[model samples]
Target chain A: MATETAAATGGQASPIALEEAGICVDSHGGAIGLPQLCPDWMGNQIFWLAVTLVIIFFVLSRIALPRIAAVLAERQGTITNDIAAAEDLKVKASEAEAAYDKALADARSDAQAIVAQTKADIKADLDAAMAKADAEIAAKTAEGEKAIAEIRAGALDAVKEVAKDTAREIVAAMGGQADAKTVNAAVTSQMKG
Target chain B: MATDVNGAAEQSGGLVFHPMDQFIIKPLFGDGGVGIFTVTNITLWMAITVLATIALLVLGSSSRSTIPTRMQSIAELAYGFIRKMVEDVAGRDALPYFPYIMTIFMFVVMANFVGLLPGAFTSTSHIGVTAVLALLVFFSVTIIGFVKHGAGFLSLFWISAAPLPLRPILALIEVISYFVRPVSHSIRLAGNMMAGHAVMKVFAAFAPMIIISTGIGLVVTPLSILAIAAIYALEVLVAFIQAYVFTILTCVYLKDALHPAH
Candidate 1:
């Protein structure tokens, strides 16, 4: 192949011949094409150095760098917009969170109020029932006391009538000798005492 | 030996030396493509490109605020952009692989951009550099595929998209496609870089000649400048495109690895 020949020829060139030809050669048998390439390691170093420098410098200076800078600038603008948006959202979220907590507290108090109202209503009902029972008990006690006083008065009147009848019978049985006048006097005296 | 003095003279002043020629750079050729190839320039450029990218990213990302400053915002945006790219292409499951994708994007973009700098080396122009990157992707995808899919990963080659009669032929083609990934990946980058630089060099060689020839040659100077500018713009576009392409391909390859279908 052409490449193989070039490689072979390029490898076999002697130092003196290469120098005469104004080419610097490396020990690896490759001739440095440009006179700018020194015969020492310096030559090889310089050649590649120039090639690298040229390519990097060219690409960066002209194309890649500008595009990158443009992209960066655009991205920066977007980020600023995004940060501003996020801060706004965060503030809104905090307000919403506070409102939510307040609403929850209100809801809890409303529930407690309902519970307290229910309890008070139940207690009122219970107290009314107890008061009614007490009134009934007092009425029953007063009625029973009136009935007892009437019964006691009736018993005393019955005892007084029975005593008069018995005494009259006893006086008659004892007399023929026992006169009505005497009996009446004795009974009247006893009654008087 | 046949020596043509006229041809030599014609090419003599026209030749633009490599940027690394300034330093005592050494070349190491592996599976040689351009006869005797050295990677000294490649290594150096890669180092500088990486360092520059890191410095920019680090400096940019170091300061973060609720209302980001210009540099901080730019850095965050780049980070988020690459993050979104990975998420979109590779899916949420590939979130863990963000670091790799980000790194690849930064390195490729940096390499491409660095080539635009005056007298700076374009690391991606060399086949060896691109090849290594491509090879790394190839190996990584292969390993991940095998690990995730086990022996079933082999079934990926047998996709039945082709007609039943041509299934075997199609499968063979598929296999070859998989093998050709590294070549295509590397060649795309290397070829683009080489062509762009070569054109620029050819134009640059005329600048001095134009100057030496007095005002007569000066007419070409504007043309040269214009050509350089045009090429520079193209290189910038190429840089972004190459980085995107490389990242996208990585996503696709990773997808195949994580989810194999027969």
Candidate 2:
């Protein structure tokens, strides 16, 4: 084939140059016939094909494929871990909210208790003060009543004495006999009536 | 056909370009027959495919980060995509073959995209390459089926649900289809890749041809360029789809192998 191509090239200057340059210028019905008819080229192609394919297979099975698989797996792991972390954080946040709500309820109850106790204490103090004031007023009233009764008794006695004197004088002026005891008795009876 | 075109183009005194010339295999070093040891363009491109795979998968995922870099994300995307595909289509038992399926997907997709570059060879375009791949899947599935089900694996072709009289005919058809899997599998990939690349080349060849005639050149050149662009876009989609189809089909076959009852 080389000699034939060489001889043909000698006759044709352009084809020879193209042939020498490794450009397939002979044009044996394009690529269709070469692989089927040329035993030499076919055998070489198959040989290199096996070599390259084997290399590729091993590289993929051992090195390339495993690496890609690992990367994918690692990415998946990261995603799952992130999701789990988010879930845990969510649980913790709920717990904190629950604690906050409980604390608020406790503080409210404590405040209510304190208010109720303070109110009771203030009421007790007010009642004690009221009782003391009532007792002092009652004592003053009793003293005022005693003083008035004494004054009344003294005045009544004075009035009786004056009546007795007047009655004695009248009896002397009218030239009629009148004793002091009788006059006193009569005045007392009138006052009593 | 190529020589005839070349002769006619020569007689016309126009530039004779061979669009199919890119598919030829020759030695990379010296002028000689391509032996099993000769390094050819197929070897070179296939090596590039391997290196590209390594770069994207091995080195790209070396970081193994929780927050991925761009390359790492791409690597991880491919990993998850193929892993899920295998698991979904082939079941969880097919997970053991995940690496192999992933390797095929990455290699074919990378080879196809790389081939789209200017002046680059598409190794997967060759039946020689695709056949080996398909054959590997074929043999693996068969072996796994036998190992798993023993004589029961043959029941994969037997349609018990069919009418009693149609069972034998249906089984025969199923057996033929089963044997034809590797052929169709390999040809589908190779044919699609070859056809897309060849169409692009044909459109490109026309772009230069427009220069031969000024009046037609004005219209044809722009049209050819536009056509090339359109086809190139479609080829990009084809590249991904072919790879996907190949991998998914492989998973389906693996499923059949693992559970051949249906």
Q: How far in Å is the alpha carbon of B62 misplaced in model 2?
A: 1.0
lDDT of 2 by residue, A122-141 (tens): 99999999899888889988
Tens digits of per-residue lDDT for model 1 on B48-157? Answer: 88567656666554443445677756656666787788778767888777666666667777888887788777766666556666887789889988987899998788
Model 2: number of backbone collisions: 0
| Candidate 2: pairs in clash | none
For model 1, the docking class works out as incorrect
Give me the runs in candidate 2 sitting further than 4 Å from their true place: A2-40, A132-193, B1-17, B208-218
Q: Give every candidate's TM-score on chain A.
A: 0.54, 0.58
Top candidate (DockQ): 2
Cand. 2 Cα-lDDT: 0.83
Mark the 10 consecutive residues where model 1 chain B has the least summed lDDT: B17-26
RMSD of 2: 5.3
CA shift of B66, model 1, Å = 2.7
